[model samples]
Target: MDASDTIVNEIEKALKQLIVICNKYSLSGSLSTVNDLDNAFPSNLPRSTEVEFLYKNYNPEKLKIETGFTPIKIHSVSELSKAKMVMSAY
Candidate 1:
């Protein structure tokens, strides 16, 4: 969800990572953190719809127990970014 701060932060971090990767390859690019919410969604769908969409969740406990596949645990943005960056390297 674009409205989610976590998602936004992850995107920002990913952009920064791309900059680093590009620079490593001698490429030039820029990243803008500004998120223009006005153009992010259809005008008919208000901001509240995004918030509700973000908050709506099916319980994850059952899936975890049944599948025995625990999701990656990230307590902070830094951890999430690091995990994603590491995963991306492969």
Candidate 2:
């Protein structure tokens, strides 16, 4: 087994574990979006424009370390709801 093969195996194992976790939580569906890069485990999130719910499980420190990427600004779902309510009031 080469380094690339080992990495692939690790990724596949991680994916299987993730699948089990998702199944346990009943989290399988188009409701989520999973973005993968370079065979790493994917970053999963709900596929909704609503900001409040979008960042439900987002952890900046963990994500940064895991993906080697800086976290982007994410609007909270509560903020989006308030904005909508304000707009409707007008």
Candidate 3:
């Protein structure tokens, strides 16, 4: 893969690791899907619709951590959808 692809791959790997860690800790936060990641930070194509869906579904106030790379939070479906919409727009 090219440099860009490699970076994307690395980011995916890191996200997976974060998810695993969250699961292990029994964290009440949900991890973003690959589609969500694309929308939140599109590489080439336009952002995916999934980002808005997530924002609308999840809540942001319950967030315990947000490192740009990873966000951990306790969110409802509605809040997630809203977050997705807000993030996708930018």
- Top TM-score hit: 3
TM-score of each candidate? 0.30, 0.33, 0.41
The predictions' CA RMSDs to the true structure, in order, are 15.5, 14.4, 8.4
Off by over 4 Å in 1: 1-3, 28-90
What order do you get sorting by lDDT, best first? 3, 2, 1
Model 3 misplacement above 4 A: 34-63, 66-90
Report the Cα lDDT for candidate 3: 0.50
**Model-by-model lDDT, in order?**
0.38, 0.38, 0.50
Candidate closer to the true structure by lDDT (higher is better), 2 or 3? 3
Candidate 1, which ten residues in sequence have the lowest lDDT sum?
57-66
> For this target, which candidate reaches the highest lDDT against the unseen true structure?
3
* Candidate 2 lDDT, 1-90, residue by residue in tens: 876666656655664565566457554231233233112222232243222222333311211112247632322333344445666799
Candidate 3 residue-wise lDDT at 29 = 50
> Mind sharing the TM-score for model 2?
0.33
